[model samples]
Target: MPQEPVFHRYVALGDSFSEGVGDPDPTRPNGLRGWADRVAEELARRDADFGYANLAVRGRLLGPIVDEQLDAAIAMEPDLVTIYAGGNDLMRPRVDLDALAARYDEAIGKLTATGATVLMWTAFDAGWSAVFGKLRGRSAIYNELVREVADRHGATLVDFWRFGEYQDLRMWDWDRLHMSTPGHQNMAIRVLGTLGAPHRIEMDSLGPDLPTDKASRRRADLAWTKDFLVPWVGRRVRGSSSGDGVSAKRPTLAPIS
Candidate 1:
């Protein structure tokens, strides 16, 4: 029988998705506690010596993520690594999917070469959202490339694009771009399950009862457009980002407290 795998050092990389943008926690660094942190907590339970580092920053594009995080993560010599990037790039109006994937593939190759168990996530399908529906084709292309990259690198793929659970509006934050707290919980469950690691994290498989009336739903959509979408578009137009002044929440590997 094969002995169970044990990971002592785990590092997370990428953008808002890995940074836990939608999952707010005042007590945690960067005022967020995302699925990556939850997965670390579970791994810590399994191994008392486990240490975790999260180098994700919100509103980052693929190039910056690779330029800023890839080398640093390698230097840590982690036993496990998780990366979810390129989503922000896909959202841009003009992105060369092929070029993007090349960079991502290079990063994954470097990470896997370190003899660490690497994990990757596909961009979630956004065809269900009116706000992001137009980018469905682009996202699909990116997801396919991501699948190919994971295969090439022998990395664990989270397959976020195929996860139908995200179809429910409740899985997303008000911005419709990030996962909510419950959504993060769901993702943590998925990641741990994929790793074949025993975890005690709770999974809420049920969808919430959302308002069905057209008028009510319309009102909510309009409010969201005004409160979130408009500002996001404005930022893009000004070449600004929400992460302008931010740094990695956890830049060093340390035991989970």
Candidate 2:
């Protein structure tokens, strides 16, 4: 049997999801400790030599991600790299899927050429969100493209789209876009499993039930619309982004300590 993969240096690339938006952590560098951070911690536990760097920011588009992060990741000469982008691109009202996929394909080509074990993901299905419900189709398209790119380059594909575990309200945050803390933990577990890496990460349970009844759900939806949706739309309208001046959490590879 083939030996399990062990990476010395790992880099995670993408946007808010990788940045750990919903999984808030006041102690971490970005005031959030996301799945990538958890994955890095687990990897470090498995090997004391492991070093991790993440070049993810909130609300970043795929273009800047490729242009800004790809070169830096390549230069790191990491043993492993995970690329999770295109979901943000899908959120736009109109996008040329073909063009976006082509760019993504080019990126994968470059990353694979670094001789690293590249990993990519299919977007998770956020079950029934009144806010982002319609964008699911676009997300699906991006997921398919991700799968195709991963296969073509022999990269590990973390296929979240088919994972039924994410099809629950507990897996999402109030924004209905990013994953909740439990969701991030579950994702770390899934990533370790996919990579055949040893990890102590485990998901105990979904915790508690969110308000799901009609009246409560209505109030939650209104709150979501007001707090998250309006600001998001306003940002788009003004030709701005949530990551306007935000910097990457981990721009260089180093031991997690």
Candidate 3:
């Protein structure tokens, strides 16, 4: 038999999705385990000895996260690093494609320089007309940019946007902004699959087609309000619509205020 690959350390860097925002199971008494933890547990089942570290913060954009978390991620010197970010950038008032791509390039460049295998996920399509509509065409542009960066960096790109479109939105939380328990589980499965793990569930097996019922529509609307509208209102109140990005050093548990 071929020699089994040994992976001893895994690190995660990104925003809310990587942190498992909507998971009800709180791993740390006061905190949720998030997707990175879930992925770590799954890896354990394979008898892989590894230490998992999640440096993702909620509501983090590209630039700030790279600045604050990139060095820590490199210090971990992990065998693998998974990144899931850019949703917040997509929701910004003025979506600048070039800036977004440049930030992504910086992030990838820094992460890959550490010699860790990088697994990157693109943004999901929430179908929020209020925010996404104005930024139409930018999603495709961003996804392509991410793919190009991944290719250049020799990283694996997991297209969560395409995966989201093929699944039921109701599987997400009541806010429609984050994944519920099952949703996180499904994501874990897909992510593991993308990383060359043999045990993987197909997206179709997760549930019926998306937009399956009135409840889903309601959830999407609620998500728009909670995830986009409310936050935007706060940003507008602060007169900070410059898309300058926030500091990534903030507490990981601080709700996206």
Candidate 4:
């Protein structure tokens, strides 16, 4: 019989998704708690000395993440690392897929070289959303490249793209851009299961009933544009990002709850 592996140090890297944007938890660091943190909590249960950190920030594109977070993560030498990136870039109009793939591959190579268990995730298929339907082609390409990179580096792949559960509207937030609290909970369950960790994470509800009528749905969409999409587009137009002054939520290694 093989002894179970225990990871003492775990670090997470990425953007809003990894930063736990939709899942608001005032008690947690950065006033948010996502799947990565949840996974850390489980890891902590397994290893008494486990320490965890998250270097993810919101509204970050792949360039800054590769430039800013990867080096810090490599320096920490965590026994386990989870990287969920490239989604933000894919949302943009003129993204260079090849460059993103190259950078991602390089990051995976360097991280795996540290002899740690590197985990990577693919962006969920956006086939359910009209706004993102056009980009599904691009997203698929990126996912394939990521799959290849993971295979090359022998990194663990958390296959989010194939998860059909996200097709449910309840899996997304009001803006339909980020995952809601339940969505985050679902992701935590997926990540822990992928790692073969013992966990008891279950989403509380399917979510509050949303409008199913066309008029009501359209009204909701318009409100979403006014409240969230417009401002997001304006920020990008000005070359500003939501992560501007933000730093990593958990930059240093410390005991996880």
lDDT of each: 0.92, 0.87, 0.69, 0.89
lDDT tens digits, residues 18-131, model 3? 766777654352266555666676665555455777777777777766876887778767778888777777776677887888888888887888788889977666555454
The runs of at least 3 residues in candidate 1 whose Cα sits more than 4 Å from the true structure, single-residue gaps closed, are 1-3, 204-208
lDDT of 1 by residue, 1-257 (tens): 64556789999999989999999999999999999999999889878889899999999999999999999999999999999999889889899999999999999999999999999999888888886889998888888999999999898899998999899888888888899888999999999888878788885554568898999899999999899999999999999999999999999999987
**Ranking of all candidate structures by their TM-score, best first:** 1, 4, 2, 3
lDDT, candidate 2, 6-115, per-residue tens: 78999999999899998998988889998999999988976788889999999888999999999999998998898888887887889998899899999999999889
Candidate 4 — number of clashing residue pairs? 0
lDDT, candidate 1, equals 0.92
**Roughly what TM-score does model 4 have, to 2 decimal places?**
0.96
Instruction: Point out where model 3 deviates above 4 Å.
Output: 1-5, 46-49, 128-136, 164-167, 198-228, 239-257
Residue pairs in candidate 1 whose N, alpha carbon or C atoms collide under 3 angstroms? none
User: Best candidate, lDDT-wise?
Assistant: 1
Q: TM-score each candidate.
A: 0.97, 0.95, 0.77, 0.96
* Order of quality (lDDT): 1, 4, 2, 3
1 or 3, greater by lDDT:
1
Candidate 2: residue 26 lDDT (0-100): 92
